[model samples]
Target: MSATAEQPPFRPRTVLLIVGVAVIAFAGFLLLIAFAPPFQGGHDARGHALSTSGNGYAGLVELTDAIGSHSLIVRDTDLLGSSALLIVTPEYDSDGAQLARLLAARAGHPTLIVLPKWLTRPMPDNREWSLKVNTIWPEGAIAALDKIAPKLAVDQTPFRKTVIPPQPAAIPRLARAAIGGQREQQRLVGMGFTPMLLDRDGRVVMGKLIGRPVYVLADPDLLNNQGLADPWTARQGWQVIDDLSTTNEIAFDLTMNGFAKQADKSPLRLIFQPPFLPVTLCIVLAALLAGLHGAVRFGAPIAAGRAIAMGKRTLVDNAAMLFRAARREHRVGAAYAALTRDLTAQATHAPARLSGEALDHYLDRAGRNAGDPPYATLAWRAEAAEDRDQLLGAARALYRWRRNRTR
Candidate 1:
């Protein structure tokens, strides 16, 4: 009995299919890695990059959450609707009018404006920042502050202390809470605000306007990550958040943190958002499917074709086509004239001594037939022909003369 062939060992088509699947899987893995967010360390200490683990106010965010207060960082200004408090941490180059408008929008809500203090650089490992306290606010911040709250004086010197005493009336837990840090100072030397929270020396660290919902906290270190590192400061920080939780919800303003809305949406932005991602995925999948379909043959392999076995007739037809494509019809007349003359002379066995017009006359006499034009007349007509119709008539006459006279 004849053994059945083992499916030609294995189909190359199957091997190709496996390779294609592997390539597709690899591409997907690369896309996932490329678009995914970068991994971060426990503390992202970059200035104004508001992450919950950031040294900015992430600790305060956690504290608010622990105490049953609904806390959120306001990335979009539209969400800055009526709320209990809108905490703005103003940055360098902040716009004065924009700040004013935001405060005006939240007319009923209290705003706690915190001045920036640190000059910092990222760590070598890229996890956090190395900090240096800058006493002077940036020129832009100063201009914005002048416009927003002209009466407030932001102190240049940091008050160095191992411990800080807190007022319990405003922050009830502050007296027992751990409060440690060099206080960056601010006070309303002019007449718009009253002291709400004071340090052991009785200096106003936090204050509020007489009739407005506006409040000002001079020092950011009291609640930042570096400050929260100490137990006392962390407690004091919690106390501050607890005091601010007058309403159920507490909104942190990210507008000053440089998270503003763009006036226009880019096309590339649409491709990533939910509305267009599915359409983009569909297009990519269709392309991949089309590529897969074209990758492998379905049935039998096509036989190999000969590289150099073209017939003479095909070569002639191709050459004719090349002449037509080049618009070389004007050259055809001269070629035909020379060919007809040579053949006629050879067929008649005319002597070489019979030159020029004498030779032409002899061939013309020999080539003339009852229904045909003389070879001399045809040759002259062909040489003089310019247009298509004249060239066509001259060609036909020469062809007939050669056929009738040569034989």
Candidate 2:
């Protein structure tokens, strides 16, 4: 066989298949990392979860627990049926319609709406507060309250600065509040609201609706992580909690803070969660097994023989067998006669003197007998032989004539 025909096996396709599978698996891994939740412990920002750091109110939430009061961070809106105080700390993006719906759900229940005042930044560590200043008007908070209570009026003007100490007040239905810190000077005009805690200038910092159980606190720091840090400010938080029924279960609304409970019914979620994890593991294992089976080689390959290696005799036998299999024995009759003629010329060296039909006729006359058919007739019969028996008899007669003429 030629060197080119005997080349070594080079299956680049197998290597390409392995690489393609690896790339797909890597892409799947990257997708999982991007979409899956991180493995860590910490509450989210935006005042949604019960966290003590930054803008979170985890201190007050935990303080309520310490004082033997049952408090929960309400993620699901369906749990708003309690008659207890529902504290809603609505951020800027809180939906007014949803807030209205929540208040409507707790129609008879007492709800405390703490207005967002300060625009504070989280520390570099993200566990402490930094740069805090009050806004001139909490328009979003006011708009939400306006949707629920149109009669309520909220002061848009910034509170006047007070150098004086906090004022002690004898407010009925509520415990004495310590007006410490800058809260003593925070001015808020509540036209229809009953003034509960007044600032140094007599502007209501805390108020209640005339007929409704809705209470409004102008400052969020009174009960947030920053407000709860001071002893005097902490008292105000407790008093506010006390005024709102301590016996009833208290639930802080986290829905406004972008913490909503979602019902996950997707197949991927099911596979990731509880009892189905094992099934998912099994499926993954099965896929890995299939990939390995497809990628790996089982054994060494067996070498095959060259295509054109047989001799002339073996080629003729194979050709005859093929003609017989195809029922085309007549097709080989002319080939057999030509082969006999060539053999006779090589043996006698008579092809130079006589050629074509003349040579054929000369040989036929020399080999003719009384009973046997003429050589020309036999040659013609071989050329036109149709059936297997006729073809075989004609081939024999031509061979016999060649042998006798050659001798």
Candidate 3:
């Protein structure tokens, strides 16, 4: 046998099935990636209302859900305008300019700004887990407080951690604030801050801005995931919100906490956004249907005809083309003369051994006997054509001789 490589080990059918399954899985993964941001359900590990981590306030949100209190996590900056009490947890690196604008807009509404304390990094092993290395610098926390209360500063060393009821009217609820047992002993300490709730040593734990309706919570541990571990602390946090909330929908702002989703004009991003999402789904479905149709299609392949055909007619046409290409037009007349000469000799029953001149003389006598032109003369005319007109004349004379002999 001739030396040749063997075919691949895998079957075509199995390969096709694997490819189809892989394509489907990839499409599912893309869909998951597109919808993950909006439908995350507040499972992040950052120190925000959307996080379920120790430093986060997601527990407070869960507490509201359990008590039948209406609350929502706000991802859009536009939602901050609602009259409800917005619990905003601003990160250390949050935009101060944007924070000022947001606080300014809520002049008529109730706003509570919670300052961040712990600085943590996400665990590489678990996405939902995080490790609080240490506390954020007092200056960094103060900068976040500076947006509305630039005069105030964040202080961890309070003379006391418990609230001191200085204002009889505000202390009724402030005194009952379950902000005790905080992980980081931090509070707002400065002059311009109107002390709504203060420590025994006069540190502002929860205070209001001078002229604005915005409130500041210096320590977030009371409402954070760690603080709300028990039922009592969770209820205290809920009570604080109930006392503050003016509107039916309580909103916790996530926009300032690095969860803001801006409009992306990239083709991949656009397809995952509104309006185009349906188009993307349709295109995927169409492709799947087309693939299915191709896979299940039935029929044996029809054999194709050969490029070069075989037959007397095909042979004649090819010879004609060759003669035309070679500029041997006179050769056509010579071939016709030889064919007619043989046919006439056979018709006259002439001997096969006869020479060319003898054959022509015998056919000429037979042609004269039949009341036709002499065979020699007809043959000479047929073999003498040099151009198109001459060739036509030769073909005509030869045809007549053959017809006369047949008759």
TM-score of each: 0.56, 0.53, 0.57
What does the lDDT come to for candidate 3? 0.74
**Candidate 1 Cα misplacement greater than 4 A, ranges:** 1-42, 47-54, 65-70, 73-78, 90-107, 125-137, 140-155, 158-180, 183-212, 228-245, 254-278, 299-309, 314-335, 338-378, 381-407
How are the candidates ranked when ordered by TM-score, highest leading? 3, 1, 2
Q: Judging by lDDT, tell me the better candidate of 1 and 2.
A: 2
User: Relative to the unseen true structure, what is the C-alpha lDDT of residue 254 in candidate 3, on a scale of 0 to 100?
Assistant: 82
State the lDDT at 141 in candidate 3.
Answer: 81
Candidate 3 Cα RMSD (Å): 11.6
lDDT by residue (1-407, candidate 1, tens digit) is 34675446658888878877998897677655544322222255544536433347766666677778877767677777757677787765678788887887886677787666665545666545554545455343345567666766544444333333444565332342223555444333344677777655555667776777777765666777677777877777667756765687778887665565431244554575688889988997998788767875688988898774599987878877887888766567877898778877787789989877888778777745546765566777897887768888898888777777777
Best by TM-score: 3
Ordered list by lDDT, greatest first: 3, 2, 1
Clashes of each: 3, 0, 0
| Model 1 CA lDDT for position 4 | 70
Q: Which 10 consecutive residues of model 3 have the lowest summed lDDT? A: 169-178
Error of 2 at 174 (Å): 10
